[model samples]
Target: MTLNDLSPILLDAAAPMINPRDVDKRLPDMIAGGLDAVLATAGAIEDFRTTMEDVAKWLEIERSGARKIKIARSVADIREAKASGKIAIVLHFQGSDAIEDELDFINVFHACGLRVMQLTYNARNRVGDGCFEITDGGLSKFGRKVIRRMEALSMAVDLAHAGPRTALEATEVASRPMIISHANARALMETPRNVSDDLIRAVAASGGVVGVCAAPFFLTKDGPATLDMLIDHAVYIADLVGPQHVGLGFDFAEENEEDYVYFGYDERYIPMPPWTFPSRIASHAEAGNLESSLRTRGFGEAEIRGVLGENFLRVFEEIWGC
Candidate 1:
């Protein structure tokens, strides 16, 4: 890989989904790991009230001392955060359960700095069915209206945890491309959470990019995954579609905590859930080397740059605007 591939503007499409209180504690690792910007999930499987409260904490972080991170409402703010040596944080919601029945809150949250929202988490919701849902019903009528509003407001649509049928159907309705913020190729690992080749192709055809997941047990079936394996998934999507449609969306939740309140704690009962914490892959502290590892494997600088951060940056520039 050439030196340019290692450019310092590493944008993590999806950092670990953590609580608002953890923002102050997680900022240092993001910088240390070579990340200049990240789409940090504010909350999932929650209501608008809780999601707003989470955003409130992020706002507090921006106002706090040292000011290590900044809120990124646009592509310009994201670049500014990187140039200033701070991690640009764009708030995200993993599931639309937070939207509840308030359709107008989509606009309200956009005004509050919320940029990304998925229709569902891991089960059926008002928006649609998740990957883990028994039925594969796609977007509901309300879900369609939600997408329209999201487009009008310019929020990135995420379908990472969405069921195959649901994700594909959502793509059919999205005027702009919808992103699978973090997921692996189902062709590689036969898990519900991992997306199918058809879904990946459709999303890319719609001008959206797929952020290859970095969490372990999802990348490989034989053993715990390494960066090498993670790249394999990213490259698979690039080869299937194009490098422009692939990016890094490592949902690296390395054993921070587990809430079995929903998915339960047994892997045998639900193999798809991340009940197995501490992904064999690297954590946020070592995220800086994600690209370095790619270089060592002899990837071209252009491809490395695209996978490292530029691809998602391009998508963000298009959807969120410069």
Candidate 2:
């Protein structure tokens, strides 16, 4: 099916969605609105895992509905979800810390349907530091080994939060084409976490895909980010690395305003950089314009299909060989 057909599915999956902060909120209405599937990040799962019973309860509700949510591991799974009108989920970990430096646990997480894993988050971990670090020491020996293990296991590696040196080094060392799951262009936003043009070209050349994040901070600095600017970043990256190599990783969450506190600064671990949070950073709802932008920019069913999920689906197929 095409994205036009898939749009309602995505919207349905996004309905009520999964709110990691509050379990009291009932998403049955949202599910009734039409949600096909959800691809939740590690942060979401970590925050909610504390309430295992709550998680089970929510999943049970979804399964009981016409909109069944299934974890996606391969292209076939994504296609099947489209055919069956179910929501396909691909569990992605934003950092390795969820596993807490234990390599053996990777397989355990994988067994639980954790398909995509990034090496680090915003700060340093046993694997390596993020782009925000003053001194990017590149990947640790253990980091390289971890990446190799991920490749061997067919887990898609993500460089979204890694430092420039770390991301480049990891890409060079990885035997497979991995993903920069969610990021913007440094050329556009100039954030440390944004991928550089060279890195973009390298990733595309290696047959990987880059998901342009819908976060305002990464898209522009002078003012609030809109869907137009978000598409501008996509167009820019497509110019540098071809349209097929780019996708949308809208990094949006369903949490309420109160839950934004969890993202507050503590500074206990690392110092915050000046541009850590860009000016005019709006609420997560600001991302709602994404679909409109994609459509307005003349992205038809095929490109929209890819950017929506097909691109990542293709990369997963390439690395997972499924």
Candidate achieving the largest lDDT: 1
Clash pairs of candidate 2?
Answer: 12-34, 12-35, 13-35, 13-36, 36-87, 37-87
TM-score of each: 0.90, 0.77
- Predicted structure 2, TM vs. truth: 0.77
lDDT of 1 by residue, 95-121 (tens): 888779889988878888989888888
Candidate 1 ranges with C-alpha deviation above 4 Å: 1-8, 254-258, 263-280, 296-298
lDDT of 2 by residue, 1-61 (tens): 5543545333211112344334224234324433344455534224324423333444554
Backbone Cα, N, C clashes tallied per candidate: 1, 6
Q: Which ten residues in a row have the lowest lDDT in candidate 1?
A: 263-272
**Candidate 2: worst 10 consecutive residues by lDDT?**
8-17
lDDT of 1: 0.77
